[model samples]
Target: MPVLVATVIGLTLIGTTARDVVSVNPEIATAATVFCGIFVQALPFLVLGVVVSGAVATFVTPDRLARWLPRRPATAILTAGVGGATLPGCECGSVPIARRLFGDGTVGAAALTFMLAAPAINPVVLIATAVAFPGEPLMVLARCIASLLTAISMGALWAKFGQPRWITRNLLRPTQQQDSRFSTFTEAARHDFLQAASFLVVGAAAAAALHVLVPSWMFDHLAGQLLLGILVLAALAVVLALCSEADAFVAASLSMLPLVPRLVFLVVGPAIDIKLFAMQAGMFGRAFAIRFAPATLVVATTVATGVGLLILGAR
Candidate 1:
């Protein structure tokens, strides 16, 4: 399916008829190309994410994760932030995994940290970011640092103020299907890919439409107004609900926006997109999602802005 999609995109981009269409009705052609480009570019990483998510489901249980963490809240939070690299799935898959990992005290905090961090800072996502912006190694670094900090900050906040009552249950209640490991892996991978890919299609379409409709002058204005740019991009991120694995390419495609706003988009999208909000609501309960999702958006935006200033420096 991905290959077929890629082939179609290639034909549209390079074929003479496509060029004629672009010249005749540029906006529609441009939007189509942008949408296809983002989707095709992101497909491989999305596949990789689903595969890794399946492996996580098959091999890594909540009990094993809990056993690995330190007892101290701060240390456990830090550990979980770093350990997020181990789960290379998108935010969709991480929600349920985090649900399984959620518990009392330090472990619960770590679970939340892992949920926020895994989607943004994992190896596959960082690699995709690097690929999307080949000239900007600092973008990858900034994303990693900013995402980690956001995760840890949220974890710390939860440690200090989070009520067990906010969650559906204080104890983790993981799936108990009596299935073979291969069966589990296949089922997990298939489900995640379908759900995540559907959301990715929506994001790509939104990005493509906005690319054509939003004027270049507005982007320049936002670039000049840093705070406004941050807020706008952050809001767009949530509304677009892009998959973590694919968001970098979409950010890269928005050439009019400067790196800082784009960075905010990348960070915020993975941490607290609309789909993630829905997933959190379904998995962790509405009470938890309402508080946690909003906080995550703020923290992710702030941390990404800070990191971008320090690292990318409005460039």
Candidate 2:
């Protein structure tokens, strides 16, 4: 609520006739269109995520998760990735869910893997990708494979090198331990939506500003340079902080760029963004987020680029 009020105030301060100015300026009009398109397209999915995440809080227990995953780290990571593909929601909900599922040793790795994988490769995101890139099936496959690998790799790395002490916050707390199931459901949904909405507005504003400010030639330059394109798009994903369900459309909007770079954008957005970083720092700890977020970005970008090369080629 505060975020929204501040944004409204900021806009009003820009000018009382801001809408009139925007309508007259071609570049500003274009940016406004893109922002509206992304926000409107993503809003339904965001709501759905809130509802599903609430349900996840209500029903998905640590004991149930333990039963589902294998004991060994390798197998558990794999299983967690597959399991994540089943859950259809956004990254915000996954944070607390991951907190609930967090455990020692191998299980801890599995929970983190599930957190990364669920948002990027889940059925909802996959379908959205396919819809966004109707004629390109390889794009869908590349995103799925790359996102899955990123999750699994992170899990393996954490299992091998991550220290529990780094997680300075209460990384493991039963979300519904003290509350009734119905209260938990409503509260979880409300909290997730409130947390996500403010970030969504900020992200959309950044995207809109970039759309208007970036030189037209800049996008043209990205088209020919494959590696640079990949890196730029991945970084854009972090900057935009778009919802997983809506990023594909944003990527698709950049029809000027090659499919591989757009794939990197899709793969990286849900994995690590400003909002996710904030959520991680708030939910887990700054100590954990500072280390984990950067690592995930590198891993996601590298994995996405590699998979894109293999599956979609440098084209």
Candidate 3:
């Protein structure tokens, strides 16, 4: 599927270039320049996520995690949600870690919750939000509340209606063992890095194209209607698929949009996006990814809007 998508994109670029649809040197050159920077910025975090995910997968025994976790479901969910703050990497990195946890026999719903919450609610993201919103601490609070609420809500929904059997059979297959934990960890890390780095390349190319082709005036036209702006930003989040570490900076640069809409950008981004959807589709079954991704989109957008308006007043 990724190959097909990439082929389509390449063909489109070729067609456009041949037809002079976009400026010859300027557009391609601009895209190349922007993508180079974006790729460099995102690669390190991708590497970090893969390493941590691999380590967790290869070395961290399920028994160890289970022993440390609270026995109660609610406690476990809340702990996982709040524990997102401690994870140092962005949303892109969280996917592999969450998958590793599930594969290693950690709770599926709980791991999913952590995947969504941790990137957005973590200290790195929070600090980025704080910097982005500067004097408006409420923006940071709204982002946190929205992230937690969305994660918890999705978790509860999965608990009630999700087919654990599907997860068990398709998504969380156990990793093969090796004689040495150190060697296993290194191997897993290398595998994860390659996988994530490839996806990051795809995402960066898309983001750079959008940056070059989409006019800044586009956002300006949608500024006044708060709900509309939030919806638009939510869609943009899916398309941009920016790293959580840098998304706030992007949001900050979009000074045309109001605080509430930008807040939605931060809240919904880590939970759902095109690159993430692609990654999830690969890791989980296609049917499962389809349902889960949309579910998260609806929930995250709704929660973000509600929290944003409640905290910051209706824009």
lDDT (Cα atoms) of all candidates against the true structure: 0.88, 0.83, 0.72
RMSD of 3: 6.2
Off by over 4 Å in 2: 1-22, 171-178, 282-287
10 residues in a row with least lDDT, candidate 3: 164-173
Candidate 2 lDDT by residue in tens digits, 1-315 = 677689789988987588889878998898888878767876676677778777876887756877899998899999998889887657877777787778788988998999999888877788878877889999999999999999999999999988888877774444656788999889888887776665666666666776789787987888888889998888889987877876776787777789888888999998999889998898778988999999999999999888998999887
Model 3, C-alpha of 76: deviation from truth (Å): 1.8
Write candidate 1's Cα lDDT for 261-296 as tens digits.
999999999899888888888887889999999999
For each candidate, give its TM-score against the true structure: 0.90, 0.86, 0.71
**Which of 2 and 3 is ahead in lDDT?**
2
Model 3 lDDT per residue over 279-312, tens place: 8877766777888999999999999888888898
TM-score for candidate 1:
0.90
Listed per model in order, the count of residue pairs whose N, CA or C atoms clash below 3 Å is 0, 0, 2
Model 2's alpha-carbon lDDT is 0.83
